[model samples]
Target: MQLKNILFTSLLVSALTYSAKAQFVGDALTFSQENNGGTARFKGLGNAKTALGGDISSITGNPAGLGFFRQSDISVTANYLNANNKGTYFGTNTTKNKGRVGIENAGVVFYFPTNEGYHGWQNFNVGISYENTNTFTNNVRYEGVNPNNTIVQRYSDLMENPQNGAWGDKLFKTVLVEESLDPKNGYFPVVGEAVNKNQVSDILTTGYNSRTALAFGANYNNKLYIGGNIGFTAFRYDTSQQFSEGGWTKNRAEILAKNPNSTIADPTHDDYKYVEANYELLDDYSQRTEGSGIDFKIGAIYKPTTDWNIGATITSPTWLTVDDYTSSYIRVDYYDKETDAKPFITKEVLTDPTEDSYRLITPWKFSVGLSKFFSRGLLSADVEYVDYSTNKLRTIGGSNRSREKAWDQDMKDSYKAVVNVRVGGEILLTNTVSARAGFNYFGNPYKNADNKQYSGSLGLGFKLSQNVYMDLAVVHLVNDYKVSPYAIDENHWKSQSPVADIKHQRTNAVLTLGAKF
Candidate 1:
């Protein structure tokens, strides 16, 4: 019954939004997710994960592999990344690139070998690690026209139009009367289309995400290992946008007069007209949320022969609580010298509202891996599976219809099969020294019309000494895609014609250093 409920809940949660913009939710950070050279070298391989020793950072990949660690160790790694973004408006082209440095992982592990153990219990191991799982930083600026007033204001109007219905009509009646005007409305009827002649442009946005997990592992009889992670995650996001519109002076004055005691009003009077003019939508929203969750993994290692080993693990879902805060301001501009109203600054109300509690469930994972030690070298590989359908978006009281819809659409449009294939081996350069190389392929999470992206990785590791060793590895990632946002039609009030094609290329690199004690 519990399993059935889990599946049912997963399906229900996956029924949410799939919009391109909506999928840009919560937190996204790459430095947090990709820290080690080996992990990045092989697109995060797990089956052959046991070959890596020291530290519990690999616990997320496979817990049973912990049995390979025979020494107490500490390791830390950092990552540097470069991101390039490209977009087009109509036929015009634009591009952007940025660089960043981040701490990847730092942790320690302790091993206790059982000298006299019964029931096949070989040893016990405990560890604490901080592994960053995601990093998100991207800037996209495409200028065509400012659709905020035309689209958002129009939607608001539709909600108020009496002819449309009671709900929308009653809500926006005042806004419509104040917006629709002759002569200088700026929105002129050209070829039966209300062309937004007002030059509307400029948008800026930024995002941050971090997750710190406290994890522990135990190996029994060197055959079975179990682990669990208690993770604390924080998400930060901010967006700012500005644009221009003409003849908004009157509407501004009316709003202030109605709300004399409002925070966005003048000190002396509720004079909304003072700010009524061609103004900019100066908006900035930020949310800092924290959540705690638990993820457990159980695994079994079978060694049928001295040189061969096979392992499997099952992972539980992570449950999180997210608290978010948002605020915005609308400022108008009157630059036309011919107008009677002089240029003045108006501060619209400030809104720092907190959302109800929200919940996030990462996908459940199942994996298997194999390793072999031969006369010349060692070889390993891993396979993993996760179900995206079992995720959900919810507030404290319950799930949000809008957010849920967005998540569902994202899942439906996304590719489900995420296959990670990695193969690496060590060649003994000397009795005490070895050279290692690995290759990994992580299938793209998003499917395309042409099916382009599936990131591939390569890395090298070197052994320094018996009790001490250091590894330096570099990884490169490439992701290319074509995505489109929701389209607007001619019937809509000043809507942008459809954007024909959108293309994006992302290249990422990481350098990781590790030391085993």
Candidate 2:
């Protein structure tokens, strides 16, 4: 039965090697999503700026809101972020934290009142702004014991497959897996069964997605506002992962006891001399991705009454040209009890990094909002829709038809459309002071996973003096997901694979300083 399964997996691995360069669906989703980030006021209001205008953030949200500017305005925003992750693997929990401080946003808008009367065109506004739209800074750690299987089984399977070529030769040289005496039986793992082996993994990631936009807006009779913007986005992402497994011994007596009828029980058997103890393996992988893209947005705001505003906006897909580089290293250690007391060690390193360049098209976004004005403050809400399945990847400057089709199929199978919601309200406590609170819900985009995120915020605004003002906001967000360290064919293994549950939390504090002239 074992031999039959080995042959089956060999064929499968052989077929997969042809499309090794295909991009993961998760990568597509990562590039398609953005955070609600801008000025402190915008963050304080849950980023529901589709309808409520007059802020520099409008250059990215609803350009039409730029028309609300009655004077030249300029502002700068800074932010501090703290992120924590708790990962649970096989019932064992581990935690890690990270922090960073940086400039979040900066922009300026100039307002020009048209010479035409109020009955016709009221005003025109132009603005330029830069914003950090998404942050990928995080750290995660998970450790546990697997009693069912070891990663060696995966390497052993690949070693037996001729289609994978020499990819697993290092495992053989390191004696992590040995070829069967009977060639028909294929390769066998030297580490034996899972049996109380400890496993640990640490992952770190850092990056940011930023955008700069030039926008224009117009006001009609002081009742309607419309605007548009062309934006350029820059992206960078880097991640490193280290995984280690150890704390087990290979005993010939124990192996024979577990399978008394096996060939190893016979002293004359060629495999009987395979006695080892205290086995360990360390694997490291790192990858870096850099890219840039361009997109366009248009929006409008309508006032049905003095206290009501209705707004909507549509964003085009961002077309990105991405480049990726990756490298890997592995080390193995073990004591050859029968040969010497000292441990035997072997290492494998890929000195040259593999590079791939491609094109990615993100999903389009549609949003609608409503704002109700009170005597002193206002309440606003926005709903946004995005179809993640619309994301696509293609080969750059060449054609890889099969790979492109496979990537397209994977996107459709892995993602779905989702709706995001934001609600916020602000009230004036005094003529010069105001308070704000908001909530945001981002829906899950995966077709087979629960990855919803929730956020809440609080803010304070101070009118220091006429043209000079300051705003402060704090937002807390939570997200949870599951990750698998490696994949194994369930049918080929007796034990089920392990999965890690990760809970991520982040807090952001932002301060905006600005003046209106």
Candidate 3:
């Protein structure tokens, strides 16, 4: 295939294509994004631990905060998530829900205090942590009548493009589409015109990204805290889509009437004999991806006054090696009425599972934060920046340099840098009770699209005993975006194609149990 055609197909058909090595701009973005998932206290605080210290979440948020530990500590967190997606396609709306429960995080910090008056260093701390940074569990379903085009038209268009080669041969083999009698006309759907086909699709995705880090921190003269961590990340993503279209109305007579100058094939041929009134097509595609990466982060927090803390951190790009596996199949069912006894015929085609591997470098991230301490409460805020355009992909064993370069260029052309903001506060409601609230805003990274995400959270902390405590947090997130099932060149279909607008919402409940020694 031509490089341009390959790029176009990879981007437009990311969800539908059966290509095993289809790493595109979307995959780059998915791996770069992070979620505020950690201990309930930190999650409730909008993950604003950059400036505030004394929490295990700091191992991932800002290792420098580990210096605030006055004693050895250990904590474990559990989470429950519920995702809801509302999709609108071709004037029809559908809602789907998915739920999952898992362990969110666990960590331990060991504090070593220096001898009093031993230089300016007050203490050194070491920490080990495991955190689930992102979850991909979701489900979406939408159906509607399409009046303009069908996926068959897209296949027909592809058949005309020489660069696409014989990829559409399977469509012809399955009898879903047929080659035109005239070579110049290319291919056409056997079921006829592209209009008024009832289309429905159900998609399900499941996976997660997690990080394990070994961190170290130090406190200097009770004012300056510095820390760094070496982090390893694990990633897995799986998605499956089942699409079906029906309501076909076509007959040999209708074809002859529409094209007066056309030549009709044999009357008994499958293409000419069947009325196609009850034709239906089913397309199923699924993909699984697994990968691992490594990154480094260093940060510092300075306290110039007893009430004010300033913090900053810089994280190096993550170097990821990914492997993808994909498989797909198509099925067509129709009935022939010309026989003495009408019979239903089914034709199916399947592709062998394929696998590919590659490497990706995510963009660097920088963040700064400020926190203010109060007699009964504290408030903190943070700002982060990342340039999505900097993401790059490399083919394994240096095998497809041109393709890799094209993907890299596409990332730069389709993405941009954006700033994220987070704010949160904790109030001591009673001697043994605390209340926390937070808000987070993730900026849009697309160059020509709006896909920002927002999250809000509320939490409570209980001092069950002097040595043990419990924290509970609830978070709500919302994101809205659009997806195209298929794409056609403007020359083939001048009008806009059908698209699905999806509004996704997620609710998370987290509980953390901790003890200090």
Best by TM-score: 3
The C-alpha stretches of model 2 lying farther than 4 A from their native spots are: 1-23, 157-162, 179-187, 253-274, 336-342, 349-352
Off by over 4 Å in 3: 1-22, 180-185, 192-194, 253-265, 336-343
Score candidate 3 by TM-score against the native. Answer: 0.92
Which pairs, if any, clash in model 3? Answer: none
Q: Model 1: residues >4 Å from true position, as ranges?
A: 1-55, 116-119, 144-234, 237-288, 329-354, 372-379, 397-453, 483-517
Position 42, candidate 1: lDDT: 32
| Alpha-carbon lDDT, every model | 0.46, 0.81, 0.81
In angstroms, the error of model 2 at 491 is 2.1
Give TM-scores for every candidate, taking all chains together and pairing residue i with residue i.
0.66, 0.90, 0.92
Lowest lDDT block of 10, candidate 2? 3-12
Per-residue C-alpha lDDT of model 3 across residues 223-248, encoded as one tens digit per residue: 99999999999999998878888756
- Model 1: how far residue 47 lies from native, Å: 9.9
- Candidate 3 backbone overlaps, count: 0
